[model samples]
Target: MPLSRVVNDPEALTITVVADFPVPVERLWNAYADPRQLERFWGPPEYPAKFTRHDLFPGGRSHYVMTGPEGDKAPGFWEVLAVDPGKSFEVRDGFADEAGVENTAMPSMRMVFTFEATEGGSRVTTVTHFGSTEQLEQLLAMGMDEGMRSAIGQIDDVLADLASFAAERATEAHILSDSQVRVTRVVRGSVEQVWRAHHDADLMKRWLLGPDGWTMTVCEIATKVGDTYRYCWEPEGEGEGFGFDGVLLESVPPRRAVTTEHMTGTDYPSTTNQMTLTPVDGGTLLSIVITYPSAEVRDMVLATGMTDGMETSYARLERDVLVGS
Candidate 1:
């Protein structure tokens, strides 16, 4: 129990919770910046959270769902208002529907999370402001404080497990649901360098080759929304080639991008890929959440050793593109 204090002030229409942890401020900050570690403890023990989208920058938005023991779900959304890197952040937190839209009927609150270095380690103070005294009391009656306490209690375990989320680890994938899978990796480079390596045609050609003998023959890039891009690769000696083409659905330079991908010349179902880059303690955290058409398609793609190929290409990116940059 790292919780040090909890205060509810009806006069100010606010509630504050303070928790301390025996970890560096950077470690504590990364636990929240990376969605993988955040989802581990964002909800109570019985109700584990799954963050489908988490962007910590100002004006960004995050969506998560907590599923109870009996399969009941509670969805929530956060609209980030301000961010000060590892120091603090402010967000408008509220309940949401299954599609992640805000539920206007419920009371929303403004919350500020402040992180600071303490004598022993670090401390995080969270102050939540309600719209009115009635909203404050209503949320209290709904056990909001207790729920927060329970959620913070699990952070210690996540903080201590450093190796599992280390930057040197290979690319890893987590099945978020039957049709959604998130692939994550931390590379030794700045977010800008990594993002450019992905968007620039010359840089991508230098590192996107999956295997040793394969060479990228075509590297067309889509820089803006509604543009389509194509890429093809072939064995250096003599072998059949493969390629993928996609349309850029959304693009936020140096932060996030969304695209729809399918086999180059096939009529197979397409997948929606959402890629997000987050700066962390060690390096840039690259997370790609792919939504397949169905569970069968998701499983089939995994069986094709997708993660292993991605790891190879990312390693090349660090060795050839990022290192020189």
Candidate 2:
């Protein structure tokens, strides 16, 4: 006999299960959409199976087979009714025979999977709808709820593993204008050494932004008032790079330098970066003041933990130059 439904009323027995997993939305969606990933955890222990001909888009079809205790195989088919990548998907379920044809034992069911992004990860809800009350009750009698609970448990394990993997791939996306981080550090190095690290092409490459492939086609700095320079930053690879076109507002070689970093590809407003290097008792006190266009930008920067990113970058610089030198 086919598996019985868990609900009795078509309207009253809508079984909805919501589960939270510590995996990013993209990772969670990929686990369901990708066949290789789906094969790892979509079945119960009693009937281990793999999806066949699985397709994730609307109007697509996926087939699967389950092996019973005596090695008997039961096949099934799912026709995707709607797909919203990384968000939701809906499908109709049917039984299939050994010959890979649809069977008449069970009525078709509408199954919907929805994903909602949470603070740390995502919440996934699966809702299954039966055609009639009798079908729902029939499924429940067959322990369908327990089977679903098992299936969802497998999903939880898969998502936990994926959370670790997704953490490494997280990069902040350019969204609002007011999100930029300002970081300050005190360096136990001479002002000249610190200034050189910021201005010298070789030193800049070693510590700051790039191996950006652009030949520095033009890096001319006046170090003094009334002199301006422009660097035609170009991307090294096939695509166009984020280019900055601005004048040096102030430059005092070993003491202070300020520039407007205006990049074409970034949504961030042009930033005025004023870096001051002062010779203290033993070393140099480096003060960096980054002024954004507005408070919103400042909040954005704080929200993304850009401060932490800056501290990390600066720590790397300290190790590479202060300690290594």
Candidate 3:
């Protein structure tokens, strides 16, 4: 992928570049809205970015550390000045301490991105202004220009990988019939990793838990067809909250499966689930078609934040298990 065209004026102490992404404006905006997306292109290929703290609100400082091959962390902070969702944002960029606090000792720059629609996609014009010639020299000496170009180069790959997943996230779960609720997410990982993450009890506990406090306490899976499996979840301290047991109707290794689910405590009727995993261009498209007893029961369950929890759980799955894997 080609890096964004760079223009640097040492005399003016400014760097200006406009990048045109083939993806939609939302995709570009999400690179900043989502930390995981931002980190993918936050730095060059050698120095992978890992965000420690990210808050996009005005006056909130987002900090991330880019780790180099030598195991050194080059921390950077963005002091957000303004945010207009899907349109533009401005921030002060500077080096930061290991603790994520900005380092006043180093030179800083004011950076902004103005997003506008275009025939092909959206055009993002990024402008950076330095305080003085010395400050500009300071950044140039640190290869700021080259690093910025390298960082921007990775945006296309990152967005392409997330296009399917982002599309699914933007859409609400569709009620296919009177009894079924379907949710799909295209996650970035090999079929093997995706299969393992979903089937492995220990790995499921790592990211399957919704929010933070709740956890999947018990995970019992029968590997073969016609066998039964059960999963239990409860609050860390509180007593049991919810669980489900299922008998495997069919199994196709990492590709597809059908199961019958029975609720443990809830009055809702049993559910049958068909999990289909189709290998897409980037990864696997995971579709979970779950059938409840009736539309009333499905609606009632959806009202209890099950859809939101599922979205959160899938996001955690992508962030914790997929992506760079």
Candidate 4:
């Protein structure tokens, strides 16, 4: 399958399986990092896995059981050798009994989980090494290859559930002062993630726009201090639309950004904007403050219900761009 491949090196007493996922590395890594999630796809199609003691660190160990449709159970254990979040991990894989006792009769192997980010998606390489070629051949004869392929195919289901569970929620905005309007939102993901969501064109396009049916057609960004950025929104039909172009006055990723906005096709005057992001309990607390030249100019922009539009765009950005696929 395109998502997974297996290479059997009998002479070297090893087998390597590399799988590609059409999702972010963090999203895909959840399948293994989360114990409950790991249980969902750790077994073959006919046998489902159930994790018991899951300690994910160096020298930690995890025990699990694979239950067949008819109630047959095959237990297993993993002696974690190393761990690198969202990157890779190493473990010693072996068989065990229902009471979590190791089955010394069964062969053991060392397995490594390595993840890499790709242009189209993410790649995870699982390499298993045996003591000798005989051990590798023994497992191959017991349907190891087929079972692994079947188990890897189940990742799609996990990814779909993750996307739905991480769906975005709503946010609110208010007038902070006569010269400034402030919108405070707790965005999903880490501080760095929040920064990238605002800067990356692909991620920004998913939410950085006004109401429904109005689309952001052009988004050009230069995130340096002396650089400029432009965005354009056009209505679906022949109706006239609006957008804002800005030059960066100050820029600090994952922290703050200051800019001056020049609006087009409106009576709205130029405004200075300050956007600050702070790491918070859940995610990143994003504060957007827009300062107009005077109360008259500020009131003029507010009269156009720009605050309502901003609320819509920010809400979408928080929900869809940062967390969603």
Candidate 5:
């Protein structure tokens, strides 16, 4: 119902859909920039989406799976091509296998999403360019048009619910899949400051402490890919100490980072952590997606009140490090 028009042009080999919303351009733009909001309406009603990774910057990639009523899943990915914040972005959209690798046999398309201020409120136009007429026709026959309309119809509800994703909210964890969990928080700091807080040894020792009475005894910062970082924590008076060491897998500066984390002195399997930061209305949105070795491991970690501890640390970060700086 939000769609004003849907055009399939054979000569141009493009499918364009225009939709209008009764919200400001920023509100509409945030829905896509933030993965939590994006997953809510990225898929049709029958196939709800779960975004495991969503990086809105150029050269970044997003991976999501749409689960059907019968528990079947269809995975897809997007390679971000360009971005003009609050205005437009282009991506190479394609189908993917269970591993999130693109299926070359299937056709992929270039998609351009444009957002603009309208007389009423705002408008969004999506132009999907196919490689050939055959590919476009193939996609249309696969219910692409109806699927898009169904997906956009759910955006109204998502936009109306502002409190759910508010910046003041505490840290929360979402189960992205059997082996993946996404933890999110909006800290009262710029993206650069938040990124630095995680990297600078002194800055980290000040706020990365959870709860109280615990001191970070060791903080070895990882400055580049392939570098290994270690962090150890000990109680002020008495308790068993703990530590974690990880190798930096990827680093994109103030925007994103990926690392392999392992508990020190433990033989347990390692976990891959992917963190992304985006500037939102109130502050910077920090999203970390952790891929565990198994569902049991993921559940066990979450059952240990991981999010609660994370919330405590984030609060300390804002109160101690970012408030004035």
Candidate 6:
């Protein structure tokens, strides 16, 4: 038997695999939606696979981290575009770095998997649509087709097992509290790269968002303790967008740096933010710890979608500082 393409068009390329299994549509759908069920059959059978986080909802996404035979781990994110319980689901897939940051990829595709009930059992057909033929060819040359085929086979096996169990697990809601959402990834890249991205006024503007009329007036790094730095953002009219200042508590060249970030817009005075960098395998682990005055203040900041903001910031850092440099 030879692999065949299902839909071949200028705008989309889809591959469908039809397998008749001795299971119902609901059981198979559970294997696709549930994180635990997905982990069982979501990757290369030879490789130990796991799903880090799987959130199936609009504006929600799932992250799967796969470790290869060489111990190198690669992360992938699937943004849930649509979900119809037990019938069909769609998602946008992309690659990310270790810090759970998405990369720059043009014309991302939609992967839709549908389940239908037949006389014998259930039929699963997965259709992936790329924006262009070049995109489809590029993905195929990258071995995406084979990888997905293996992954779906794993899903098939897991669903067969689930059918024997006769009990479907409930989906868990992915929710985070303000105080519980801590800054997770702190990566240490080359000092020149890091400095160029973080300290440079022009480059900072590309990643960090500011008010309507905001500019970086003062940015000084002494590379030592007791050094003070201030970033002043000017607003258009009568609005608070100034006096964002910090003090360098510790600084070591290309190794570590600690600073205190203060926001004048907040009701409270400020908070203590510490950043540390330690040398690791061919790189460094940069850890950031922000201590708030109270739990209430922390919750308020989290409620403002700061976690998502930081995730996007780190993604920019990876692209500009790590990849571009």
Q: Candidates' lDDT values, in order? A: 0.93, 0.62, 0.76, 0.76, 0.94, 0.59
Q: Tell me, what's the RMSD of every candidate?
A: 1.0, 20.4, 17.5, 17.8, 0.9, 17.8
Per-residue lDDT tens digits of candidate 3, residues 131-209? 9999888888989888888888888887788643553452146564567666666666776788889898888998888
Worst 10 residues of 1 by lDDT: 316-325
What TM-score against the true fold does each predicted structure earn? 0.98, 0.47, 0.54, 0.52, 0.98, 0.48
**Highest-lDDT candidate:** 5
Q: Could you arrange the candidates by lDDT from highest to lowest? A: 5, 1, 3, 4, 2, 6
**On TM-score, who's better, 1 or 3?**
1
Predicted candidate 6 versus true structure: per-residue lDDT over 177-240, tens digit per residue: 2222224343446535654566566777655443224444544544458877766655555765
Report clash pairs, candidate 4: none
Summarize candidate 1's per-residue lDDT along 138-220 as a digit string, tens digits.
Answer: 99898898899999999999999999999989999999888999999998899999899998898888999997899999999
Candidate 4 TM-score versus the reference: 0.52
Better of 3 and 5 by TM-score: 5
lDDT of 5 at 70: 100
lDDT of 1 at 98: 66
lDDT winner, 4 or 5: 5
lDDT for predicted candidate 6 compared with the true structure: 0.59
Candidate 6 all-Cα RMSD: 17.8
Across residues 170-202, which tens digit of lDDT does each residue of candidate 4 receive? 444445445656555667678788888778988
What's the residue-level lDDT of 247 in candidate 3? Answer: 89
Q: Where does model 6 exceed 4 Å of error?
A: 1-11, 105-107, 163-325
